[model samples]
Target: LPTSSSSEDFHESSSSESSDGTSGTPTLEPVPSPVPEPLCWEM
Candidate 1:
């Protein structure tokens, strides 16, 4: 379940990043993972 864990971690970090104005970094990581596309775009 590495992907699941990684996605969760990405979300947690992304949430924090969203408040910091550096959200782009987290979104970029998920761009290559098709499953995370929606999540990334939503952020």
Candidate 2:
């Protein structure tokens, strides 16, 4: 029972971490693109 509980906790943490990483990538990509777009527009 204890092992199963621990496994569940581990799985939850792993899933959350994976989700965070996936989200972080998209946010970072948009940030750089916006920065370049304004510069390109001004130029």
Candidate 3:
């Protein structure tokens, strides 16, 4: 966890933000990519 914490710190360094509304990073929702339909064979 410590390593992860350090990595998070590094990320924070690269990123400008604070726990308090400082970052203003947009909250983006994940959108699913369209999947191709499988081919159907007639019996």
Candidate 4:
């Protein structure tokens, strides 16, 4: 579900970028990575 939400957000940003066609090499920030919890050592 979180991944879907992030993808939806990305789509929205691209649509906005379309409006400014001549921005000349628009730079985008890196997407935030999800941090995984540490696995149990004694599992």
Residue 5, candidate 2: Cα error in Å is: 0.3
* Model 3 Cα lDDT, one tens digit per residue, 1-43: 9999999998776444544474434321122222222222221
lDDT, candidate 4, 1-43, per-residue tens: 9999999998868756754774423333222222222233334
How many steric overlaps are in each model, in order? 0, 0, 0, 0
Q: 38 in model 3: Cα distance from truth in Å? A: 40
From the highest TM-score down, the ranking of the candidates is 3, 2, 4, 1
When 1 and 4 are scored with lDDT, the better candidate is: 1
Candidate 3 — what's its lDDT?
A: 0.48
Candidate 2 per-residue C-alpha lDDT over 1-43 given as tens digits, one digit per residue, 9 for 90 to 100: 9999999998677556656557755755678788999999999
Highest lDDT scorer: 2
Off by over 4 Å in 1: 17-43
Candidates' C-alpha lDDT = 0.73, 0.75, 0.48, 0.54
Model 3 regions lying over 4 Å from their true place: 17-43
**All candidates in order of lDDT, best leading:** 2, 1, 4, 3
Poorest 10 consecutive residues by lDDT, candidate 4? 29-38
For each candidate, give its TM-score against the true structure.
Answer: 0.32, 0.33, 0.34, 0.33
